[model samples]
Target: MKSGEACLHRLVDKWLAPATVLSVRVVRSGRMPAQRARFVYIEAIAPSGSRGMFFFRHQDGCWRVFPPHDARPSLCVDALAA
Candidate 1:
């Protein structure tokens, strides 16, 4: 997994512990939305990128952040683009 994916996984773990992350795969990155922050978008790959966005945020001085899962979704994913 790429560094982004690794970071994403960790965030997901912290936020979705019992929920289970299965895996994280960054497909694409986008420009930093004109916000000068510690993180910025590089590109948006597609399916994986779109899926990954759901669990991303800007937290603790970092972007692509994932908070703990407060609610469960209809689906759980263990792959890049499920």
Candidate 2:
């Protein structure tokens, strides 16, 4: 499994421990056309018979609970040589 996927699993295990994961789906967000999957949706059932959905986003080469911020254009200054 990829590092990002592994991170997602770890997150699920940490936050949703003792819960049974029902399904996991990966889909790309239209906002970030350059990258692969921008988000992952997971469906799980807890020991208490409660169902919940989780969303994970790909950011900084790993999976995170929050979405990545949009990249903005920036200007860079270069030094001049004689």
Q: How many backbone clashes does candidate 2 have?
A: 0
Error of 2 at 38 (Å): 1.9
Q: Candidate 1: deviation at residue 46, Å?
A: 18
Candidate 2 — which residues are off by over 4 angstroms? 1-6, 19-37, 51-53, 57-59, 79-82
- Model 1 lDDT tens row, 1-82: 3555446545544543433334445545443443322332222234333233443344343435533233345654667475
Q: How much is 81 displaced in model 2, in angstroms?
A: 9.4
List, residue by residue over 19-75, the lDDT tens digit for candidate 2. Answer: 364443433323345544466555455455544444545554576666666667875
Q: Model 1: how large is the Cα RMSD against the reference? A: 17.4
Candidate 1: clashing pairs of residues: 15-68, 28-43, 28-44, 28-45, 29-43, 29-44, 57-65
RMSD to native, candidate 2: 5.1
Query: Which candidate achieves the best lDDT against the true structure?
Result: 2
